[model samples]
Target chain A: MDEIPPVLLRILRFLLERRMLFQLLEPYEWWLRRKYPNPPLPQFSYQVTIHTIRNLYGRRGKIAWASLFFPSEFFHAARLIPFYPEIAIGLVAALRFVQTPLAAAEKAWFSQDLCSYHRGGIGMSLLRLFPRPDFLFATSSICHGTVGFFEVLREIWNVPLFLVDVPKQWTRDAEGYVAEQLTAIARHLEREWRVHFVWDKPFFFSNRTREILLEVEALRQRKDRMLLPPTKNLDYLPYYYEFLGEETSLRFAERLKEELSKPSKTLPHRLIWLHLKPFYSGELPALLEKLGLGVVYEEFTTPFPEELSPSSPLKSLARKILWASEILATSRGRIPGILEALKRYDAEGVIQFTQWGCRQSQGMVMLLREKLLEAGYPVLFLDGDHLDRRHSAPEQLRTRLEAFLEMLEGRGSS
Target chain B: MCTLGYFCRYVPQELLEACGFKAVFFKPDFSSPQCSSLPVPFCALCKTFISWALNHREFSGFVVPLACDASRRTYEILRALSVPAFSLDVPALAGETAVERLTENLDDLARELLAQSGRSFLEFTASLKQALEETLRQQEAFFREWGKRRRAPDRIPLLFSGSHFAHVLLPLLEEKGFLVFPDLPENRILLGEEPLSLTASPLEDLARFTLHRLPCPRLSGPARRTALKRLCGTLGLRGVVIVFSKFCDFQLYEIGLLGRSLGLPVLCLEHDTTPSFPQWETRLDAFREMILHG
Candidate 1:
């Protein structure tokens, strides 16, 4: 093969570095669409996934899987390979390969009335697109999706599965439950993997956790500041999901820090979009950018870090898991965390993207808006879908976002 | 004639009837046809109810109890659609305060219904109270009959999945030779009878029971293990029939976990509001076959 184009090479490097072709394909999504008309080579995709998995396992010499959001860092600390299915599902949804396997999973269970995420996840698993995780762990902070997803995987793969049950509201007991589950998971891993995870290394994990969270916080803060007037924060999406882990988090932090130190770019206003995939159709950020407003942060990308107390690994893990689980207790249960982000970033307004039929997020819209408003933040609740782009009221969302940004700017100037 | 839709083990039909509405309880079909079309996770009882509402236009309004997060959020969705809806806040299973709260909620519901329907609260309350009393009495009688069947040396005590079958269906199952010991109303009610005197929030108590008491298909390992232990110990159930709604992923996901946790035979029945009787009948026959042969 002749020298790959610089863009192609960058894509390949990204994929190889992430140890997954999907990660590489994620950024070059537009290219993939342009190159392959019909169903992009299934064999090729499968080969890439298999190759990535083998590489990951070979490198780590351990079986580990990272769940979405909080439990991910704990998995990383355990020295096991980490994989975020939400990231995979997000990529698939973005790439529009979600429909087929989602349909298939629905057919298997004779269910047509489930959430598309669940359908897509089941679809991905059925299609063998999702690498079989050796150990599966998820925090019940968001929805029944985590529980159901893991259970299905357990049944199919007979893999050791763990569910960290987070209550709808945060409480001491809930936190205790999380700590307990984390310990249980740790114990399970100790027995299964036969590798004793050092419980006394408190500073390493806690410090790492603090560092990652602060970095994430800084990124959100910087994005908010840059979103001042005509500037846009289009680049935040990839940075949020792709650069979350320890390996790339510091680099992302530095990049964001460097950007923030510079003189503020004049933008329309600073607004926070709630639970929105900023890169939907790769147009949201561009559209908002064009409208002269910058989306500073999203509720989904809150800088809630998962830190386990190595002093008592199991209990600490449970506590951390419980803390993580607190996310799913209510629709806007994640709002407090977001509010923290808003305060840290000095965000002016908030926009909650109420994706139609997303019960978990949709139900919390009113509560979230109320909370945001009470906190002196103006909130505009917009309804749309991530998977089915047709359901998106782009004009409506744009108008709402722009209007909110304008109000924020006016308030800021006054 | 206005048609009202509701769900649960014991739907208050008299209240609906007194308000000049035809009350219909539609169970969710968890099978393929209905599951794929729905946008939210089908595990939520409210989603199943609302999806039915969206697809069927005949319903004038919906009546739902603030039972769980799913139902509460579902009410929001309904409210947004401009659907005339009423939420009856049931007290969590705990204290005198809980009972007081429930009675107050019921009174409020009665007043709201009376206002909306131009009906007398006294008349509706009297009718509803009588109907509820009748249901409690009937349930007592049914429980005794079920107990008798369960005690029968020849009949195997069956643990019917609580999340799957409604209370109305339990009596029907008991009548059909299956000794149905559902994990909800009967077991939870028994467990929750003791009035909690502590200062713990009644809503928390209710949430706990609703979250932990009912056999949620999405329970973690410990919960699942405990449920399996309880199913084996308390019920002495020879087998379990997972009466999962068609699109409900929770129970289906738990099938393997439950199977592994308990070395028992499990037959999954994925049904919806349509009641696909023939398919269930076939599954039941097969289940019976497994019970007898295996």
Candidate 2:
């Protein structure tokens, strides 16, 4: 649980304004290492996570609302601390730490063909890495993994678990259902946590929502005259998942909004990321930006605020889920809304990120690229894993992005 | 000369019925353990269709669209068992090219079916079309009747569990005096059909829908419990019939959860295109008895 990298430690020390405390703790780290030679570490990463979370919240008196993306905003809005186990489990799977435990769980359950993420998450939960969440909320927005994963947690932990139901596609009725479920969950939380869950929390939820939406809208803005600094790709996930509900998240979003409002730095060719995690190498976005090519929008980032409607809270949630659903629905189908956004954002090319062994994504890549081509958008289908660099075709992706950017520039010049 | 029974989906049921063979469309019970053994990952309706077809000998054949991977696999498994299966490959799109390809596939299939069953394609096609047209008309009429039945005194109104099942099964169930309250299909279809303003990637959509739609027993705990509570509250439904296709893993995973949550008598059924009228009749009778007595 205490495997903090020195650099990250320094960063955290800086961020938390604990520089003097960090120096005081530095000598204790050496003394502790000598006192306990080879401290017994938890075999599973989730166990380590559980220990870390228990340490954090126990001291601070914060309750975690473990959730997926669909219920994330609502949970955040309700003022509950949100934890995304998928991001953690995904990182573990990519790192290949919990394979044996995952395999054992899969074999034990006789679910050999279940998604690796499900098996891994279950393995982590079984190992008690998640520490029993105060409340577990899952969205039926995507896949059976979270549903069963949370059920196992409920049975094991005997805690309150809620399923935020989202419809298969986005529609008004689905929005109504989602809104009702969110409201129900809100009531349940209020009863259990002894805290009022208000939707009209001025600067807390609604302000954050407005900020997220504005950030998204800014990301959608074109840099035809090179007015804005290109948004970093690596910052997207951490900004959303890690910083969500934190005051820093709102501040960072504000920083981005401010940066976008500034005059041109360098006009970069704009591109859109289709799927897969873009921040894996940490070099792609920087490289693209260096090469005067900016990633104007990412599929995951845009769906959050773009789906929200100020008039209807539940409808907004449902729309967000539906918007999220279309991104993963099928390969060949055209998301007119997303396409229109790409055009509006002045994205010259689209990068379809394909993770290996992700059957759902792999199955639809060819079809999706074909559709994008038909729509006259220069598309680059890049096959790689965000964590598993061994499977990454970085050189190929770079080549494709570069070539596509060149072609766009050529078209513009002609 | 040989009669056949087909369940849901619009394929060979009409043709088989028109060929002077008795065609009975039966929906299966989806809660039973016997129904869960089939190989599909989601949707118990397919399994019920298959289990009935395999158990009963009266029905001579089955026809289905290979619209999905599981159904296609089910068709193969059933075909190998000498079920005299006919599979029509329907494209994802409903364009002219898809229609042409489908017509050709169906024509070839219709010929082979005609020869094996001692029926001509011309006669079978005309009759089958008529039966299908009749079924469509009957389906429409049933909806109207269901609307009237909703207002009746003895109407056992049951809320269909989810959008996936409610889309196809709700109307059929409603026609039989069960009114589906809190419509799930109308909700799903309404959302699904609306144009997106900002959509996620296509893969993301698939993942989301698969997560939501695929009836995994393990994942649907919350949904099953919600459905059970709703059923208990709205209609005080005497019994719940969980319908799914054979080889659907998601729904099979859910049976225990649903059963435990509801405590109401649950009848689970699995089906493929194979006919199983006798077995289904027996099960339906048993279910009816349980509802009346238990």
Candidate 3:
């Protein structure tokens, strides 16, 4: 798939735009599901990935393009398909289809210094590869890139954009401010779509999903080994936020907990993976295996177990965004969570992978490194692009990982 | 009075002054720090701010505006390093809700500054009202003076827009026979002329005043684009020179929009806190020729 020519991709995109490509993919999806059933996390993830792509690319319904932290439940309530550009670009990068779109975006005046995920998505927008978004929604919660990226998308698509500005300090006034905006968007969406927002449905499903995720976390904590590989855990990033308000997500979470109930691989050193993993290549993952470094927990995949409220659903969403989301919480806010994860997994050290151009995450390295060191946990910093492999040197990454692993082992022996 | 420095215009100078602090815009004149935890991808302004914070001990406190991700993180890093600092969260959107949010934030900032200064509450309120009135007057006078400046017909008139504007480039642009009106946060004299009367709720009025300014690319709304277009037309500008720091997402993202909105030739140049003069000279010369000839 990675080797598929640009011309072929253009043709596929044309077919997909016209809703003919998924028909061709149906047979392939069926074969894939039969060949690799849902017990293994990778196979289950593969099934989910195909369904997500087909659903989103099929363009069967009204779609709203959103940032990572934009509540998926709003779209669910409004009967609109939520498309996350960052996740889509990550998948595209993993399959090696990112080069063309990336170049297209850069040519379109997107600086190479911006996040490649956003740049790649911009490229796709320029090329008209994705379905035309009817609306664009972004949160001021986590990454500042979303505002600029979504603003560009709004210009590209000439669609309405709703920006939910989440405040740094979580207070009643801030909650009300965000809740008012969320309610306004919801009302506007309802009027535009002629649909009543059934917030109850999303709340029910997401709450259940949250419950199961807690069970999974407890199971992982009880285990002495890594429940899943870091790369495999990263594959769940897209699905984590996008599918929260659906029954499919709930079922997947239950299955994930069930899967985690079983025993997993034990390695020399259990390390907590920070930020994002390299999605463009397998060299880092392979290196971790060779170094006998098992990732016990991933920062991006950590869940907030707090359930959404039915009475004040919008406020619940506001609270979740303001208080629960670790991405919004600066480095100091994340220290307690990191320390808890380290203790839970009995992780010997931390690997803080700084994604190229991700200032929000990368800025934390200094403070996080200091805090982690103070907590008696050694941190290894890896600098590379998660989506663009051209920025990564496998030799340099391997050397760093090997050295960190050896240090962990020496600490264990002592 | 305690002298506090700020890099962003959104930091309420009136409120700072009312609270008995001398507020001044601080521009970074240093290279990237030799040893820092901030990533290399951070905009030069941020790295330089970090470098400035580490080296300089002149300011009593630094008011870090939570305007961008880099700025927000820089605040945390400053705190971790135990620097005397205060964070004022600035909303990116412009509207009533955002104005109200900013007003509340500014009120909180006033409290912090007052606490730091140990000024009496009654005296603070009196000073705040007086300061607000004076700021509006100064801004109105500044607007009058700004609009009357004559553009030399011999030199191509251009609007300089971006997050970071190096004033050293002023002489360089002048020497190259180009008249550049810098539309950057650092040039606070060009802020919005919102002739809003000072009300009892001075913070709210100030919030409206600040937000109404020709917004930086970080802010989203029709007001900024409309303001920039109006400024270009009023000044009879031939083109826009977007001089942003390298790796700054806010300025980088605005390049396309400025070209589309301003309806003029757009020359985008990336620089650090300390820019390369020869390279800028070449770029500016070509841009000037393109405007003058073509």
Q: Residue A208: error of model 2 in Å? A: 4.9
**Per-chain TM-score, chain A, candidate 3:** 0.93
lDDT of 2 by residue, A1-414 (tens): 223344654564354443234344445545655665534322222233443343333423344545456545565566555666656665554444545445545444414344444555555565554434677777645443445556755755667777664444355645665676666667776787775644444225434745665654764474533322344533345346544544545655655555456555655567776664633345665666767766667665553544344455555666666556555542212356557767788677777665443334443444455557888887776666554444557678778767877888887798
Clashes of each: 40, 62, 0
| Docking quality (DockQ) of candidate 2 | 0.05
The TM-score of predicted model 2 comes to 0.50
The TM-score obtained by model 1 is 0.58
Task: Kindly give the stretch of ten consecutive residues in candidate 3 chain A with the minimal lDDT sum.
Answer: A222-231
Best-to-worst ranking by DockQ: 3, 1, 2
lDDT of 1: 0.56
TM-score for chain A, candidates 1 onward in order: 0.72, 0.68, 0.93
| Fnat scores for every prediction | 0.24, 0.04, 0.73
TM-score of each model, in listed order = 0.58, 0.50, 0.94
Instruction: In angstroms, give how far residue B90 of model 1 lies from its true place.
Output: 17
lDDT of 3 by residue, A88-136 (tens): 8887888777877888878878888888888888888888888789889
* Top candidate by lDDT: 3
| Tens-digit lDDT string for candidate 2 (B1-294) | 576656544454544555566666655443422345432333345556666678766667777555443444346446645676776644332223333444555555566666766877567655655554464455456445544645656655444443133345555555555545543322222222332221222222212222232222433555546644653554445666665443333443354346556667766655543435567557756766676667
Q: On residues A1-414, what C-alpha lDDT tens digit does candidate 1 reach at each position?
A: 212344654564454445444444444544544565332224334433443445453344555444564444465456565666656666666565555655556556524444455555666566555655677776555555555666666665667776654544456654564565566667777787775654334335344545655654565565435643222332233334333434444444444555565556545556666665522366666666776666666555454455545566555555544554465444434667778767776767776655553556655665666667788888877666555454667777777767776777777788
